[model samples]
Target: MVIFGVVQIIFSQIPDLHEVWWLSIVAAVMSFSYSSIGLGLGIGKAVEKHADYGSLKGVGIRDVFHDADKTWSVFQALGNIAFAYSFSMVLIEIQDTIKSPPAENKTMKKATTIGVAVTTLFYLSVGCVGYAAFGDNAPGNLLTGFGFYNPFWLVDIANICIVIHLVGAYQVFSQPLFAFVEEWCSSKWRNSNFINKQYTVKLPGYGPLELTLFRLLWRTCFVIFTTLVSMILPFFNDIMGILGALAFFPLTVYFPIQMYIVQHKVKPWSRKWLILHLLSTVCFIVSLAALVGSVAGVVARLQQNYKPFKTTY
Candidate 1:
């Protein structure tokens, strides 16, 4: 965990997401690498002798996982699924950085459509294949939860690729948050040199990079605090579930619908407005359910056996 945080801290120093465009490219490749590897491993497992044949409907609602009600499991699953597609918060930030010969929105729309479609398909394939491989006994995290893959060495490689992919994803998702806080601080403390001053340091393989003492200190602390919390909690899926459920409806569903209504000037109570609002309401319900279920799961885990740093995946 320390090493992961340290690596993130280093990448976080790159100033902004725009400055490290290559990082996303590399991260995308790493994502495909690990995902493809997992898919292949799953296929291999499924074809092997005595392979598990899972139910088409998956685990029942009355089923139990780790002594928790399957209803909560359903909720957690919804949260994770929602989180997988919740990129709206960072989507605008990325679109803002595009170098446009053509229109930026045009590029963004094309990218967004293709990106989302491709990712959704890949995730579905992975989930389906993984479930088929392990059936009802499938682990929460197919990659890490597996006791052993037939070719364990490939698992190690996949793990490395995951770390690399996350290093980029962390910055992609977090840069917006960092930028928001830093900008707010700078505005409030305009006269404070500690917050306003910029220092240019020439580093090899990079141009005269502009940095600030406050940026370094603040970003480092943010990484440290988040890392510590992660280590202490020893919960992965539940935390992701909570974050997903909390952010998905507001950022991805509600705001987008509201924006569309305003941008298109669709009259209130009109067919389009009604449809959009209806979609948003259904999403809100899903998000609420996910949030409640995830929170309950976390509480259950805490009560059962949470060893913090001592807990192993």
Candidate 2:
């Protein structure tokens, strides 16, 4: 994912999304293929009842409530949900990628609806089928649960697809972050050659660099910093939990509704305004709880002296 972030930064430098939209399509297709495969495998396993594998042996809805001390489970689940549905963060940017004025909003709305519906259905099907196949013994990652002994080729294909999809996804999501940082730096260094139009600098080792040193410095540093952090704290679930809790509500729920209310000039005490505010308040509360729970989980894991890349089980 971190490597993908760097790839995203590089691709984001391209001025037009239309030029690179094919990559996104390819990623989407790959994701759909892998997810479908996973669901298919789960269903097949459930039906086959292979002797070595305990297929359908423990098939039932797993108990939801865990020990009180294991609050991390709840938070982790919330994080996963938030992460899955968090595409709202990049919706506006995606919409901007479309050409034209009148139909863009409608098209974007339709696309978003379809995307969400399909993603939700896929997730639900995969989760249910995997649960039916493995019951309480399912691994955190569905792919990981399918060990090397059984149909290893499918696992390999799924993993490869995941890698390809993430490469594109990282670029799609990280572009906005890169743009924001670049804009900020441009504003701060107004006189710099990088921000100035028609300004180029010549270097001894390399021929004329188009932008100033600041651009390369900041962008490279940002990628390096994120990469290092990812390496140091490679707990995917925990990190996803933290990010989702911290970002999902504000980015996905609160800001969009708030912006709409403000744009429409809704009366402060009006029903629409009141309802939106109430919804935002609820999201805020949930976000707070998730943040606290995730933080506690991280601290607990740290206290255990958990090492990255090491399997606990």
Candidate 3:
């Protein structure tokens, strides 16, 4: 997110902000895999060590495969693949945004800081308005609140950012899935873990056709998906608002707070736990309302879009 912030700062100053957005997306795609793969793999390892089904505690290697299969199924339904891929890209862009310029470039550093500060102020201002209007149950993106406030121009700007943010999130989420697939397939085929499999280039005559076919199919599917999304762009804000509150909000805000509270073993007297516990509680409530409220907002939007007219003349 810091990287994206930095990119946003630089790109905002540039005349071609759209180009910058694309560049940021590309950078995110490249970095997502490396940044997030550890998280899923770590979970898999933990599960392998634990979650013994009593009799299966000292079983063969088949336990690992069985657990992996279960995990993969859950991952598919949770839409983690898309989310991880997108978040990865956004994370890199945000990092770039927040990073300090080279020491020698003092002028650029100062300017960058000023730029980020201003951008942060803008974000904060929107957040304030959003929170005031919707209280703790504000949508994940402030733009939805802007729309509720009946600001058309802000809505348009929010739409643009929403697209960029979604693309980045998709890249972030996809990383773990790609990593899991690569690891699982390699391990299963080679009878060894993925990292241990030495790279081999013994290409048979069928290799070119297979590679070409895969590329063609992937690209075709992507195009179709893009078209479908474009067709549904009108309601993208509402969809994202609900999803952000339900999935992203819980994972990013609530889970971390709860995790830290548990990790630190906070007692009733511990200020840290008390604060975090309160925060988690508040966030939990807010998330619930945000999920429900965002749905209401969507329904209202649909009504406004397709309202029934009455003749008064």
Give per-model CA RMSD: 1.8, 4.9, 20.5
State residue 54's C-alpha deviation in candidate 3, in Å: 65
lDDT for each residue of candidate 2 in 71-164, tens digit (9 for 90 to 100): 6566666776777767887788889888776588998999999999999999899888777777766666788878753789988999899988
Candidate of highest TM-score? 1
Off by over 4 Å in 2: 1-19, 50-66, 194-212, 308-313
User: lDDT of model 3 at residue 211?
Assistant: 21
- Per lDDT, the best of the predicted structures is 1
**Candidate 1: RMSD over Cα atoms?**
1.8
Among all windows of 10 consecutive residues in model 1, the one with the lowest summed lDDT is 59-68
Question: lDDT, candidate 2, residue 3?
Answer: 60
lDDT of 3 by residue, 1-313 (tens): 3343333332222222222455556644433332232222323323443322233222234644444433332323233212222232233333444435454346544655775565455445443444444443344443443443334554464455555654554433443343344456556666543334333333454232112222233334543554454344344445555665666545656666776667777786588767877777876665565556556555655565443222110
**Candidate 1: C-alpha lDDT:** 0.86
Ranking by TM-score: 1, 2, 3
How badly does each model clash, as a count of residue pairs?
0, 0, 30
Candidate 1 per-residue C-alpha lDDT over 124-189 given as tens digits, one digit per residue, 9 for 90 to 100: 998888888889887777786454666888998898999899888889988988899899999999
* Error in Å for residue 14 of model 1: 1.7
Q: How accurate is candidate 2 locally (lDDT)?
A: 0.73
- The candidate 2 region of ten consecutive residues with least summed lDDT is 51-60
Indicate the residue-level lDDT of 70 in model 2.
48
